[model samples]
Target: MPNVSKCQSLYSALVSRFQSENPSLVLSDTISSWLYQSIYSIYETSGEEEAERYVREAHMV
Candidate 1:
């Protein structure tokens, strides 16, 4: 659980850094697209439970 939290924090920080560097980036749109891509990729290569967890965690952030 600690590792999961760490990864989430890292992911959030990376997203924030990217947004700060690219001021024109639209976070909502970018995150939506990323979420779609992530879900599709996960579904293609991993189990449904893991994919669902990822989506849930991402949303929680």
Candidate 2:
């Protein structure tokens, strides 16, 4: 846990929450489309073209 910064942990927790909340939504074409929509949604909200460094790093876990 120490290796993960606070931001990384929080980001991961949010992602985990999505998965945990909808296990049925976590796979297949459904998830693919959701991920696509999410990509746009994230950028729309954050105005960022790419993921933050901590998000990229924490995703590896």
Q: Could you tell me every candidate's TM-score relative to the true structure?
A: 0.42, 0.37
Ten-residue region with minimum lDDT total, candidate 2:
1-10
Looking at model 1, report the run of 10 residues with the lowest lDDT sum: 1-10
lDDT by residue (1-61, candidate 2, tens digit) is 1222433444555467566666664456775455445544554556342434323433312
| Alpha carbon deviation, residue 28, candidate 2 (Å) | 1.0
Runs in model 1 deviating more than 4 A are 1-27, 59-61
List pairs with backbone clashes in candidate 1: none
lDDT of 1: 0.55
Segments in model 2 whose C-alpha atoms lie over 4 Å from true places: 1-27, 49-61
lDDT value, residue 61 of candidate 1:
34
lDDT of 2 at 55: 33
Q: What CA root-mean-square deviation does each model show from the true structure? A: 9.1, 10.4
